[model samples]
Target: MIRHHPDKNLLLEYASGSLPKGASLVVSAHIQMCAECRAQYRTMNTLGGSILESCAPQAVNDKAFHRLMGRIDQAAEPEQQVTPERSKSTEPMLADAPPVVHKLLEKNPPIKWKTIAPALKMCRLKTGQDQYEVSFHRLSCGGKVAEHDHRGYELTLVLYGSFSDSDGVYSPGDFLLREPGDVHRPTVTEDQECLCFSAVQAPVAITGVSGWLLNRLIPFRPG
Candidate 1:
């Protein structure tokens, strides 16, 4: 069962399209797997639609419309463009993979995995902006990541298997958020490997001697 979830305010931000793209992507992935959150998102969207309908509509100026149409007409002139064909490999490997996850991978071809540690491997994803860095992490069972904290904010969504930290155990579809001051070590106790999608607003900061040493070799963005 899914134990972790995004708070109401985060969901509200996602529903209103106010959350940053990197954060929104993780929330969307969670919504695809969590029925409770999906229902909440629907309710929020319905409320938003109702509020929008209740607002008075603004009249468009005729001159502005004509100018917009003129620009559109000019752009409509034929221009040769090439479109690449999407490959079948773009499909998600997991049967229950979230739509947003699939969509993301479909646009940005998957990257080759590289080992950062003994049991940890990761690859980057397209964030479209420098505001946040997004990536996929896979940790083998019995692997324990160094205890660390974030510089700004971090969102992690478990996509497969399970892992545990100071707070609790996170299974597939679980959503975990850590702020600048929060610190924890994630350990994979289950026999299966853990796969997660993570986004960080700033770089992660190592606390201990071992972490500090590893910090130099691993480039975790700093706030």
Candidate 2:
């Protein structure tokens, strides 16, 4: 069972198509995995449709109408590929991973893991969005990350295995959001490795002597 969920305001933004690209992607992934969230999203979408239907229709100027028609004509043309890209190697998809994860991998292509600390590897993603830096984090069982504070807002969705921090344990499909200055050290359970998808508005503001020393070496992000 999923314990955490995206806040109602976040879901509302997603329903209204106003969420930032990276956030929208994570929300889409969560909705696919969480039945409760999926039903909520559908209800929100239905409400939006009803509201739209009740609104008074407005006259479209000739130029605007022509532009809209042009877009429709373009959308009607079907010549591009419909299949999602796959890895050249036979990389099996995770059994419980949402479709959005696969779509994201297709868009980014090639998964390369970078070791930032013992038992922890990160794969940064180029999501074509300037507002957030997205990535995947994998932590082997018994692994722990140095405690750190958020430089800005961050969202994490667990895809596999369980991890624990100051607050509570997070199992698969748990949604976590941290605001600036929130600090916590994450540790994976001993039973299995943990895999998570993360989106951050800024680089982490790490604390402690060990983290600072590590910062000097890799600095986490490329300059």
Candidate 3:
């Protein structure tokens, strides 16, 4: 199981349609597979609906409303029957493909992987001008990600294996949101490799001797 998750604020923004398209897509995909996130999204939706209802309403033409209702009624009817050839053509390809996990492991990502510490691999998936950047991190068994703090908010989603820090142990489908003041040292377990997808606004500020070595080799953008 992968451990990690996106920040609540980010999820709220996504539910309200305020997040960027790319980030929203990622969150939507994650929510599709994560029941916890789905619950959060439902809460956000409820909150948004309340806010919308509190606002003044615009007048609608009576004829327009009637026409819209008629159209909706038509749409509610069952779809026309399909022929065997048409049914086959309309079916989704690779209908059984695993969720976002496979897509995240694309060989040709916009950002290429750069070796960091021994047994650690890092790759940036987006640039900060986009409001957030995603990073793909792979750590071998027993690997350490070095203690670090964030400048802006950081969202981590575990896709494979697990990692632990001061906060707690995170496994697959777990989400974590680290604000500016948060700091952590992620350590992978000895039994399996850990893969994580992180979205951050700034680079990680590394601490300690091991962190210094990692900072030098990782070529990460400074916070």
Candidate 4:
């Protein structure tokens, strides 16, 4: 069962199209997986539509009709854009993916997982900008992540298996938001491997004396 979710404020921002692109993507994926969030999103959209309809209408500029016609003409003869070729890796199956994520995977190459630590493998994805770094973290049974605190906001979505932190245990389809002040270490459950998608706005600051000393040498920051 899903035990966690993004807060109402973030969902409202997503519905109003005000969320940053990286954060928006994470919310969109969660909406697809959680029926409760999907219902909330639909309700928010409805309310927004009602508010817009109640607003006073403004008079169009004199050149509006000409501009509309020009746009129509351009649409009639659309330009053919070129896209990069796909690599040799097999294409990702749609399966349970949301439309946005599925389309993105179709355009890009398959994920190439890399080992970052013993029992931990990571597959990073481009967020199309430097403001956020997104990655899929895979942890083997009984694996543990170093204790750390976020420098900015961090969003984590559990995609497979389960993990536990100081707050509680998390299962698939769960959403967690960690702020700059929160600090915790995550450890995978023994039943199976845990896979999670994480998006961060800033690097992480390692906690504890040992981690702090290692951070100076290895820069244990997040993307």
Name the top lDDT candidate. Answer: 2
Q: What is the TM-score of each predicted model, taking all chains together?
A: 0.81, 0.82, 0.65, 0.78
Error of 1 at 164 (Å): 0.5
lDDT of each: 0.76, 0.76, 0.62, 0.71
* TM-score (C-alpha) between model 4 and the true structure: 0.78
Tell me which of candidates 2 and 3 scores higher on lDDT: 2
Q: Which structure is stronger by lDDT: 3 or 4?
A: 4
lDDT of 3 by residue, 47-115 (tens): 877998999988889998897575444322212121122111111221221244234434334445577
Q: Give the C-alpha miss distance for residue 66 in model 4, angstroms.
A: 16
Clash count in backbone of candidate 4: 0
Candidate 1: C-alpha lDDT: 0.76
Model 2, 1-223: lDDT tens digits are: 9999999998888766677777676777777778787777778878987998999999989999997675444322211222244434233424456666776777775788889788788888887768887888899898988888898878899988989998999998899999998999999999889999888887786689777777665444411
Candidate 2's TM-score reads 0.82
Q: List clashing residue pairs in candidate 3.
A: 1-172, 2-171, 2-172, 3-170, 3-171, 3-172, 4-174, 4-175, 5-175, 5-176
Model 2 pairs in collision: none
Candidate 4: segments with Cα more than 4 A from true spot: 58-95, 210-223
Candidate number with the higher TM-score (1 or 2): 2
Question: Between prediction 3 and prediction 4, which has the larger TM-score?
Answer: 4
